[model samples]
Target: MSQAAPGKSHREGISLIELTEMFPDEASATAWFEQMVWPKGKRHCPRCGCTETRKASATSGLPYYCSGCKRAFSVRIGTALERSKVPLRKWVFAIYLEMTSLKGVSSMKLHRDLKVTQKTAWFMLHRIREAWSTESASLFNGPVEVDEMYVGGRRKNMSNAKRRELKDTGRGAVGKVAVVGAKDRATKQVKAKVVESTDRATLHGFVADAAAPGATVYTDEAVAYEGMPFPHETVKHSVSEYVRDMAHTNGIESLWSMFKRAYNGTYHHLSEKHLNRYIAEYAGKHNLRNFDTINQMAAVAAGMVGKRLMYRDLIA
Candidate 1:
């Protein structure tokens, strides 16, 4: 995005005056980030954790030189935006656009809204998606539902010849990626992973890892998951039965609808390589749909440090 006039703020859920007060100028934003990122007074070198450091004379204003490691770094040094020449304001605006849009703001849309070239907009959004790729250790704390769905192609839509060629659903799912989902019903939180296969060994293992032991897990009567070992229950779909005394895969299934809608409505296409980051964005947003938008923005921005993504890598 073209840098905005000074004093503008893109933060959501707060008044213009409030956000403006928070980030009145470039200096203030820098200070705000420094405090937020290293509140404990230890600026561990991004390249190496060296306790002793001083500002590098080669750079102006607040860059640190780690004496122990002979490295210079700043708050953005190891973040997704580390080497990016785009201003911090664009990063803030880009994240605001990503978090606030339900379906998603396309790169084209972000290009229009942020007044940046499409290439810059695309890279920026992908980097923001990187932050959304959370390694949250928060296991599903309540009743978790696990299921798998074929994400691509309707058998009815494919050409008969092409469908015939791709009919074998074995040895790497040659056409479609097997997706596993776990949804916590009470919290309405969902987590999904792009898995290699949907075999019993693959799907069940992912479910157990994401959800705690003894959790009441529910799913459909997929023969692939007949003998699940964790307080398991199933609702057979073949007998015209979808639910029995509140047993169903509806929660995780709803997540699939939302995920597909976002991909179709905004992103238009998704590759198997980038699907997990996209899933992380949707699941994180869905899990906290009830919370204030600014809090979600903070959570995303707070994760920007200590990780890096090159513009080339995003495309590759």
Candidate 2:
């Protein structure tokens, strides 16, 4: 197994040895969790933040007592993995697979790799995605790239007449949801949302929400962006020059490529109902693509604090 030292090369990603080394057993993972969760070592009460604590017993697993709360609780009490039946090792390992992969990993494929049932793998993937979801700051600053992509359709799914219509009309992102994104080139962070139309309201609202005041936005010559109030630069694809003076949608363009490939290659069909959750899932991974997969995993575990995703809500 590999040991991932801090400040490792981002391009190298996770080494196979490092993945294996993460868990010699469930105990190894538990120890690792203790290290992360209690780095300051005070182990304060999650409920009241009281410093007083007591151990249940060495023989009994999950032995933590909080004096302020005057109750016993386990480490999984407030995490996404809370009340989960899966082992911590499996949970952490699943996160590792999700974070390290370039495009993404599918639940079906994860079922094969992790030796879990497909249903379990699917549930696990969704839960892990919830961990990566961001809840801090309001938007990005500086130059932003905005573009739209068509996600759903098949070449042969369309009737011959419809196909001809599409061909004649030109591929203008027809019959697809308009996904708009803002990419901050300097920070390499991106935020994307699935919108209803390429209409001015949708495009402009998304851009305004994602970027800060006076920030420049970059986009292609899409009519949807007509009369935008914010300052933006456009490149004409028809003219065959994509980049002019270091301004282009290449960063966000690259994001679209990987996102589409991951969706097409894995899962295969994405239902429109829960598309936004999947959007948040991929966006979290892409936005944090620069961080350590393990560190990112740790952050997600930490973030699961005070949040809840009920199974009923998930099914609904």
Candidate 3:
């Protein structure tokens, strides 16, 4: 309900009053989602990809019927919202909160805000994150900054047995997962992934996939980045050299810093099995940070198409 601070010139987001006025009810929210998902003003069949459809009977939960598929479907049928019982109004508000919150919104907070169970809120967040799994078609043009970071609970916070087990294997990054990312200096967009290891092939392959041909790359003095195909430069962090004539990986490191803040401050624990999804969510949010709040929310909705994450599969 709070408004922006005094004397701020730029518009970052809308007021709660505006949000409520825009989506005052489930019907309004559903219409807005329909507009974003089916911009042509007509619903298409997800199964048969047919545009010929009719309204369903009032008693049926499905809102549309496709003659080609002979099936009843709702706007949620093929997207991350498919089979979800939560109201569209709540989904709209959830996407709004997720995009606006700088650190991130926790499921517990979302549960209180939406009046839903904590378990349901947790699943809802994961599904919403599922909607952020958009992959960029074009590669980043240089000079791109690349870096890798380890994500997990700190070593001192681990249990005695776990600490000993990790010590037996190795010291740093022994039990943590490695996440490598890149930031395009030209477009200011970012890309990242959670990898099994930070080996030469893994790191180099990630940079190669993300950077365009003939683009210049900047990285730390990690030996894995020594033989990049593109024009490569490194800053020797081991000797406290961070930035040396536009050769620093600071841009990508800043992206990792934001992700770590969200990790440590909001979602305290991120399992390795689901780490990639979380990384994708952060990268997507970072990539779209400059857009208007409503457009960012609409992008999440648009990306929801052809994507669905079931609770069973998520847990499995």
Candidate 4:
């Protein structure tokens, strides 16, 4: 693997060698985590936001002690990594791997690389994905392309017994889940979610949540999108009209292509329960593709704060 440039910052480039060199031990990783979590280089109590804190002891697992709150804490207190027994170095490496992998790093790959159990690796991956979740109150502005894609196996591909068990709705998407996506043409940002149905109400609700009012919306000739709140345009896929002068859902379609590739190639079987997290993982990467490794890591790290996902909560 190529090494990062000497004297260059971590955000510029991060390779395996650079990662190892930068964080050779737990102390280095802890210090770096503290810096990232508290940018001003001062440790504060997560409970009460008190700055009056000191190291608990030389060898304590809970590193910091807060005088105001009378509690012990660490950098992991309120973040996704909270209560995790995995070392800081491994967490750092996992963060780097998650951000750097284009398609996504599998739990098995993380297991082998990080030398953790497959179960632990799986949990760690989910916690890291929790950090990638982004919430924005602002709607997607500009010419937005909206589309829906079905995710699941085809009826013909299933065994005879399984086929008999499933109802033949006479539709291709009979047993598949629907994922609606919206892509901004100008910003190249994507927002997607798993929806129960692709009817007019569902599609319109997704469009309203994603796009601003009066925004130009482009989609295929789907009747569900007929009365969209935005200035709508359509390209009839059934009539071989894929594009008509900057009016097409190709942008969002490309996002679906990427998502399908990752789903089929990397994560072969995704449970419907955790499908939203998977969508968020891919959508976060799609939105932050323009940034370098460091900034991307920083962005993921920034989301780590104020979120906690426990193992029981995850499993439940």
Candidate 5:
């Protein structure tokens, strides 16, 4: 067993103490967020995109008065943090916790640490995950590993009534949800999503969306991945042939492993309706693994612009 070198984990990036020192107060946190979101130092109206905005003197919440739209808006407008009652400082702390954790941070832990209600913590987590969701069209250029996993526990472990509701009479992944993933070997970036099925069309669609044409793709012996446009290779897992030189789905398999552990340990029970959000959260963390704490936080904050999630919309 190989052990990590001493201070290996602590060597890179800002420590928790440094984070605390950097943002000692609410004003400091606000300033940091402002700098990240408005890097050009010109405050534009998020609604109208007007640069003719002035600071509101009476409002202590850093509200900006937009002369173009004649509306008063805060820095949180049009972002994931819009209309949120939670303080900016607490939001920063929650982002820090979410980014720093290797597996994930649960809403229960966030509730305890930030002194917020469980429901609020849960909402906060989902909104932050909204910030992490990527709209990038960039595809994996090099060797890409693709795989699928069934989320949720065994049907045999469910109660009789629950099993009956799901009609999960058969064994092995009958009631679980399917998620497809691809990992780029060169960039070490990952992209994953919840799929309705692991059929040929669905699997191929994911591969088409994630991988560039002419990229080498690796997977386990799944018939669904047989006829992709890219160069495809497979290892027969059922025949105990896990790896074939450079051809293996190990990278995607490792992603599923970490995702499963986080799901089982931290979240425990996940609704099928919201499973995609959870997938985005884990994938985002995996994609941003190389960034430091501040840079990670900045990256997420950058994603916040022009994205908003309402409570009603989230539930409905």
Candidate 6:
């Protein structure tokens, strides 16, 4: 990635015109991707990890041939972009648009902007999300805020049959997917997942995995978070006590607020089956919020390696 200061606007990095000038042709975009995927000017065969390679036939779409694997491969192989027909330049543009947009880039908007089919645009967005999907190896050191949110359509908007089926389920958060999240105050990075339940075991397991030992954990007075292994504190939100001393879930709650805004205002509806991918996208982007737009784009490109999201598998 480029060595640049972190900022949101184009002033911190390349503007649209600058980006266009930087990648005027397919070859230029390909070189940039190669730089990100294989930094330090070292390119290896993705198949066999061999350093020996040579130019492929002119008729072959693949640019290089791996002598060890005896196969031709491009940078797209073994990545979320594998088997994609979209041009690399358009992919770069899509990435820039995806990163720059705080909420997210919708398939319709992306299709319109890139002159691609809506279905292709939708798949492209999901592929980018898959590329950003990652698990932080290090645990949060201290003052981690934990919270859960329900994502789904409103009861009023649901069909009568669906409403009737969920009538006995419960009132608030019924017929909705529960997502638990933790935000590290020090790093300002968040990790979250679409959980099957918000029970004690589930919530506790999440906190235990996310927070390091002896780390301070903050949460609302939820029964699930009653017994935490780490040094824990609670703010009684039920009685309108949000903050007491250094205890508050405001950070995680704010993350939920932003996610909900994107959910409602941008995508409008996120299917439960793929809700986790959307969560990963939001959380990943949130973690990279401070980086320059170009750097953020490079990060996504770097993450593309070792990930492959086939259209068949995605729909399945």
Q: List TM-score per model, in order.
A: 0.83, 0.86, 0.93, 0.90, 0.91, 0.94
**Tens-digit per-residue lDDT, 126-223, candidate 2:** 78777655634677786888888777867677778878878999874666666777788767777877788878888988887888888888889888
Write one digit per residue (lDDT tens) for candidate 3, span 25-142: 9999999889887887977998789999999887776889898988898889889999899999999999999998878899999999999999999999999998767678689988
Model 6 lDDT tens row, 1-316: 5554544453365688988998899999999888888899788899889989889998877899988988999988878888999999999999999888878889999999999999999999999998667777789997899999999968889889878777766556777899999999987889999999999999999999999999999999889898788999999998999899999999888878888888888899988999999999889988887787778888999998899888888899
Candidate 1 versus truth, CA RMSD in Å, comes to: 6.1
- State which candidate, 1 or 2, has the greater TM-score: 2
Worst 10 residues of 4 by lDDT: 1-10
* Prediction 3 TM-score vs. true: 0.93
Candidate 6: lDDT of 233? 93
Give candidate 3's root-mean-square deviation (CA, Å).
3.8
C-alpha lDDT score of every prediction, in listed order = 0.74, 0.74, 0.87, 0.84, 0.85, 0.88
For all predictions, the C-alpha RMSD in Å is 6.1, 3.5, 3.8, 4.1, 4.4, 2.1
Q: What is candidate 6's TM-score against the reference?
A: 0.94
Order of candidate numbers by TM-score, starting with the best: 6, 3, 5, 4, 2, 1
List, residue by residue over 1-316, the lDDT tens digit for candidate 1: 1222222144236554565676667676666566556766666777777767777876554478878777677878777878777767666667777877778888899899768999999888888877667656777766888887666655566687767676664323446667888898876778887888888888778877888877888888887777776787889887977888868988898888987888778876777778888887788777656555566666677777666788777777
List the candidate 4 regions with Cα displacement exceeding 4 Å.
1-12, 58-60, 156-170
Which candidate achieves the best lDDT against the true structure? 6
Per-residue lDDT tens digits of candidate 4, residues 206-308? 9999998888999999899998778998999989999899898888898888888888888888888888898888888887776767667767876888888
Poorest 10 consecutive residues by lDDT, candidate 3: 1-10
Steric collisions counted per model: 0, 3, 0, 1, 0, 0
Candidate 3: which stretches are off by over 4 Å? 1-12, 159-171
- What is the RMSD of candidate 4? 4.1
Between prediction 1 and prediction 6, the one with superior TM-score is 6
